[model samples]
Target: MFAQVRHQLCPDLAIDLGTHQTRVAVGGRGLILDEPSVVAVDSESRRILGGGAAVGRVAKQMIGRTPDGITAAYPIRGSVVHDFDLCEAMLGSFLRKTGRSKLGLKPRVLMTVPGAISPVERRAVTNAAERAGAGDVFLIEQSRAAAVGAGLPISEPIANWICQIGAGTTDIAVLSLGDIVVRRARRVAGEAFDEAIAAYLRREYSLKVGSRTAERIKHEIGSADPLDEELVVEVSGIDTAGAVPRKAVITSEDVREAIAPVLQIMTEELRATVESCDPELAADLADVGLVLSGGGAQLRRLPEYFERQLGVPVRLVDDPARVVIRGTALCVDHFRQWRPYFESAA
Candidate 1:
């Protein structure tokens, strides 16, 4: 009775806890929160700043600019909770900010997890959400959620392929009859690309750059393929030898060259995953193609690049970044029916 009453008053919640960003959704409502999955805390005391609410965009902005007493960092890595306390604090703040706190009734949450996480890592996610004031947490695999969010006909007999290139990890899956037929997960993703850019700058220009700056450069000039005309952008960083600030112009081709290794790993793994699938399903992928979602899917010319190299059509889904969260929301809205589709978050 109490469960029913609480369900009536407060809707079920869904969360996509990506390494680079976190997104939240409520049943019967669309996306309610989207922000960088960052937290700022007192370095010595290990307490979240801003009255225990310094999370998301506010904390992300503090990265590389914090004082000696404070540190801003990501609580999650590769879609797994690296710092349980910080993850709880960050989720708590998002919950509060989105008006999810109930006086005594915690909201039930369904969180998406990467395909390759261990059981222990999965438990950490459940524990973090519970500690963050969630009740009856549920877990859905990330690729499965992305397929759902992309509105794939996974419930049908045909195969559907989904590739979610997130910040810390990339998950690819082939779904058929509402289940994963084959899947792959890799740790090298957006952050790896950023690292590659930084490394290239340091190697080629003697400029040492930070992740944020590298990300900006990637957004401005990075591409999966050569552009019609080479795109160049001005970037600033500290010179390695002089330890002085310097600026340099970089091109999209440079970024592509820098991140080639990481991209190659991802592409190889994707192909291997497809080859490992059932022959029938692998053949079906020719018709279904591949659906790209997640933050990394925004890389310029990514779809075209994949299609060209893999010999399979690739397309980005609408609102690619929110695909997992949207899938979680869909699960929350039809909890009874979808409950069987995911592992219980307990």
Candidate 2:
């Protein structure tokens, strides 16, 4: 029945399995699903929610906001799936939604994988999608996806440097001829930024906060360095003792100091990556500088910090949040032409 047709033909899907989120674009019909990597399960029933309520923005809101009897979790971690069973279920939701719109087209997905995972890790991604109802799967590195999203000429000979700072990992790469010449993947990105903020608040303000609260603070007032005139924002959280409610006006400088070590490590990784690049590609980078893409790029002063450390120009992309997804869609749409640029399929 449905299985026969699914095995024979399916539309193509592009997935950005980021630490913070998983974005699915079906033949690039403009990102069919954009959801937190979280999945909610009814343990007693051992069943998943209806596809209608299991995917996309709705699922994101349920995070940290869900009620009892429904437990939530992220099947993916550090850009790789840690729980394939749950990952497949989550993917199935997106596939169902996409098929409803396309009138029954099973999709062959091209997913973005971190450059750091091993071949075994890569196979886990393909296996999860197949179990989730994918007819076929292709794996593209996160940096390559980001490069394409940033409009870097990866197919050409020029070296295009891309650094994707995401929720769970930062992928730094020097790309030429559509291949990664030098790259580094680290689990220091948006989540780390939030952690840095949390640590800073605890150390400086004696305030205890959850990761979500810190993420809000990072987005609202976090910076790599102090602004010309520091800005302040009122924050609400509990005191360290017995979770008493408290409020404070935390300044941008506080955030800057909290996230300093993270920024330094990120910039240092970029510098080291550049140092490892082939001379020709390194020379090419001089002209191209560095293009920052990913959720982490939105942090203030990041560009200046990298520019100073790498001694090269650094600029953030136009849309940082969806860069990886956009690039994934672009490749999935042109799978025939760009398929060669992806990693070796296991």
Candidate 3:
């Protein structure tokens, strides 16, 4: 008990390493670092550039705007780290910025992951956290972390189904007895949504837009169903016909059309996972319904879309984008009690 208390008192950290973004939280301090998973590097100097003074929002602006010598790369993709070196550099910067409340005391770490992440990837993620300054590293599958964050009674034996649509991937899980009963992971998420929107413009409007622009359009007018008002947002892109920059207006209907296929795919994936669940667990889900959380949950009519497709009510938790981080902090706050359930880096 004394050792457990000592370990629990350490200034711990919780990191949600998504392909599109990385969120770092100090157990007691809330979120201190939230930024795109991108890192800008100067190839010749072999040094990470623009991360010290410009993390989160600032570094994000450097995307598609870097000079000849510099390159912006995402260390993570589809909720897994793809570039170990860049990932380490990125994690180091975040840890430095997300300072510990206690000086010189190393923090025990809890890094989040997708439930289906392979053993090889798990070891790599754990190693990276240790190298990046965590005293001890533990992995929490994203769906479980998310379920906790969404306020599901996962500790109870009844079923709780959740779908987390993040920037890089969509994770669906059915929980009971504090363990996942059914799990499904899909890489079709926000980034894919942006690509779909961009492709739609290219074909219909004869315009070329960057991923960022498409994302803006999605947020401003994106929807999976009809809106109270048919809104329009002005978009700037290179006109395919003129090969010059031009401004065009996109409507909610256009946005819906662009996103339909992928939305259908997401819905189908969740439904399929639910269908394949064990008979006893499947019966539980019918009464409990499913909860949708994450950045993609912010999309208009997304819940309704899921509800319609599955015939099971879909509810969105508050501030879905922060659910993973919040749940991570919750885990840290209760680490001593949960430690045995989590495997450490060692």
Candidate 4:
């Protein structure tokens, strides 16, 4: 049949165009691509370096270490397309890497976006994907994708609370009956935590480090709550006072202190979201509890921190980082059933 031949030529793709990372999944296949959302370009020409091959993991490594003529940049910021041309280029490269381009047919793509992006931002995502070799484009909110990815009973009458904390944004939502009831999206998340750590080092230790190094320190020792055995990591950075390389031993306690303000803001936001819910839904939430996903969900003791702050049961989903893409992929596999929830970007 023509449909079968078309399917063989080009299948559907589910893409999570995250601020920190980009993930892709095929309709009949699981995740096939996971890479940092980074691209290296010529400083003057603004052309993608290495004939467009300097992207993803390769470009991520060039950050904070690029030569004078080369720059590493993230085309997506806060889960929105910040640089249209670069985003198109980066996505095109990723699509080609998937080998779908070789079939000479554009694939239909389902992409996840933050719940709070403006109409213009929404269009930009579709435009970028279209220009990047997609035949048709569909958009879905990240929070909904996270809910589905976490295997929550979103179609039930009871409330399902999902908080997806990624690198640049946090999407908090309450869902029931396959739709969002109330949601909050904020630009504060993993990147803020990294910035806080970097600033703390600069202010408290007179050590200046790059974002990547700070992120490393965070992953190694960061915690929201006290650990049974606190961790310590040696960090290398430039001494602001002497302008020379130096090393400092930072503890989990220090990281917690540095990121406390950011965490406080997130906690307040979550509380506000809960308060915004109707009394009936709020009651349902109290019983069902919160489901946490995304990379930030892996923060040390984060579930315990939220439990103490929100006074509710908190559950972190398995493979938290891939939840959105996985859920989006699930939708792709069952497009007919999930079609009503998607906004057509074609």
Candidate 5:
């Protein structure tokens, strides 16, 4: 009863702490905050810039462009907390932005984690959230969250496949009866695609580009399959050999070729995951197909690419990038029903 009243006064929060982005949603309210998972700090002091306010979108804008003595850092990497202090600070800042702190109650927080998170990593997440003013911290698997958010019939005795390709990791899982049966996670995701693009430019064009520029190129023209009418975009970078600025026209074909190897690896992992499942569950996948969610799901022709590669239909959920957070929010709203599925990091 006390917990219910406390929750009524200050609703719980659901957080999707991704490598490239962090999203927060209230128990009853929908998503309230979505920002890049970045923090700007003083290089020497290692203190956050702007009185600890240079976080999220502000700090993200400084990536690859910050002047000397100002460094932009990502506290989370590959869906895990890499720097505890920075992550706590970042999460605290985001929580304050939601105005829950003003209620003088520490809200219980439900956070999504990668399926293969280690014990130490799980503890780190719980500790960070507690230090960030959370009353209680719960963890949910990202793939399961994606399944729930995509509106999959996970409670039914059928297979529900989900592929959540985020900035730092890809979570693949087959869920049934509200539980995950087979799962796989990989570090190669959107960041890997950007790195592939950068490396390709450096090798073929002798051009040096930052991660932001590479990401821009990918969004502008990158593809997983051949297009009926190819596209091209102008790229500006430093000449690797000459140490001079240069510009080049890069085609969609080049981007596709650059990222194909990374995509191929993900495909193989997905195939292995499917093969590891029971024959009945595996066969069910052929009918229910795969659901794609996350920021990387927005990659052009990704669904088509997966469909052709896996011999299964691929469906991309609406607002794929927000799927995990949405699912976490749903869990928060129906905590009693979903509580059994949550793993208490504490």
Candidate 6:
């Protein structure tokens, strides 16, 4: 009777606590919050600014342009909590903004993290959520969650392959019987691409660009393979040789060349993951192919690039950015039924 009463008072929440963004959803509802995982704090007081409104999108825009006493930054990196208090504050602020209760009672929260995160890292995530007014923190491996979000039949006997590329890491896995058969994760992902682009411009064009500029270049023209009609974008950066600000015209070929190394690394890792699958599952993959999820999967021609390299048809999932959050919501909606998949939050 007490449990029933508590359930009525608090709704469960599922969150994708990502390196660059945080996505949240109510237990039975779909996604409700999607924001950059950023926070702005007063430098001297070390307190959250704007009465908790200086978070998410607002804080993200303040990056690289904060005032003297304000600092805007991400509290989480690579799906791991770096600053516990700030993470809590950021989560709490987002929860409040998304209409989670401000009352004494706390809600059960389920969150997703990379498959290879350490036990201590997992504990940190739970602790941050608890501090942010969550009860009964639950953890789910990102690859599994992506599989569920991609609508793969993980409970069936056939193998379901998923490649989830996020800002900080890429998780590739094969699932069968609702469990991972083979998996590989690497810290090299979207951020790495951004850095590579920045480095390439500095090296080849003598232009120094900020992180955001590099990212824009990537989104505008970055590609794995050549396109029939090439693309180009104007980029603003500091003139490395002259110490002056300038703009340069960057072509799709330039972006492709810049990111080729990291894309090659991703391809090799994905190939190794697929090769390591069991014989039966390997055969199943021939029919099931591969499903790509996450923000990185939105890159144009990504599916074709993977299909050519992996020798298997690769289909990008719809709404790739919200796949994990949707899957996390499923876990929250059917918590009791999916409890076995939750990592022991001991």
Candidate with top TM-score is 5
Q: Please provide, for model 1 over 174-248, each residue's C-alpha lDDT reduced to its tens digit, 9 standing for 90 to 100.
A: 999988988899888888999999999999999999888999999988899888988999999999999999999
lDDT of 1 at 345: 39
Q: lDDT tens string, model 6, 172-200? A: 99999888989999988889899999999
Pairs with backbone N, CA or C atoms under 3 Å apart (clashes), candidate 5: none
Across residues 1-346, which tens digit of lDDT does each residue of candidate 2 receive?
8754553455577888877787878673668777777776665774565543655566565644766676666788877888888887887776676664244554667888887888888888888887777766778888988998989988788888999999888999988887788989998888898998988888788898888889999999888855788788898888886679999899898888888899889988887887898788888898889999998889988898788778888999998979988998998778778877876456
Q: Please write out the lDDT profile of model 4 over residues 1-346, one tens digit for every residue.
A: 9767887678899999999999999989989999989999998999988888899988877755767788888899999999999999999999988885545788989999998889899999999999999988999999999999989989999999999999989999999998899999999999999999999999999999999899999999999999999999999999999999999999999999999999999999899888999999999888999999999878999999999998899999999999999999999999899999999643
Off by over 4 Å in 6: 43-46, 62-69, 100-103
Candidate 3 structure lDDT: 0.83
Give candidate 5 regions above 4 Å deviation: 61-68
TM-score between model 4 and native: 0.96
Q: How do the predictions measure up, each by TM-score?
A: 0.95, 0.90, 0.91, 0.96, 0.97, 0.95
Q: What's every prediction's RMSD, in angstroms?
A: 1.7, 3.4, 2.5, 1.6, 1.4, 1.7
Please write out the lDDT profile of model 5 over residues 1-346, one tens digit for every residue.
9877877788999999999999999999989999999999999998999999999998877655767899888999999999999999999999999995546789989999998888999999999999998988999999988888988889999999999999999999999888899999999899999999999999999999999899999999988988889999999999999999999999999999999899999999899988899999999999989899999989999999999999999989999999999999998999889999999865
**Alpha-carbon error at 200 in model 2, in Å?**
1.9
Error of 3 at 109 (Å): 0.6
Compose the digit string of candidate 3's lDDT tens values, residues 1-346: 8555665566688999888778988877778888888876676865677544444555577645766776667788888878887788778778888754354567788998886677888988988877877777899878888998888999798989999989888899988888788889888888888999999999999999988899999999999888888899999999999899999999999999999999988888888877888888888887788899999889998888877888887799999999999998888888887676576544
Q: By the lDDT metric, which is better: model 2 or model 4?
A: 4
Consecutive 10-residue window with the lowest summed lDDT within model 4: 59-68
- Which runs in model 1 stand beyond 4 Å of their true positions? 1-4, 61-68, 100-103
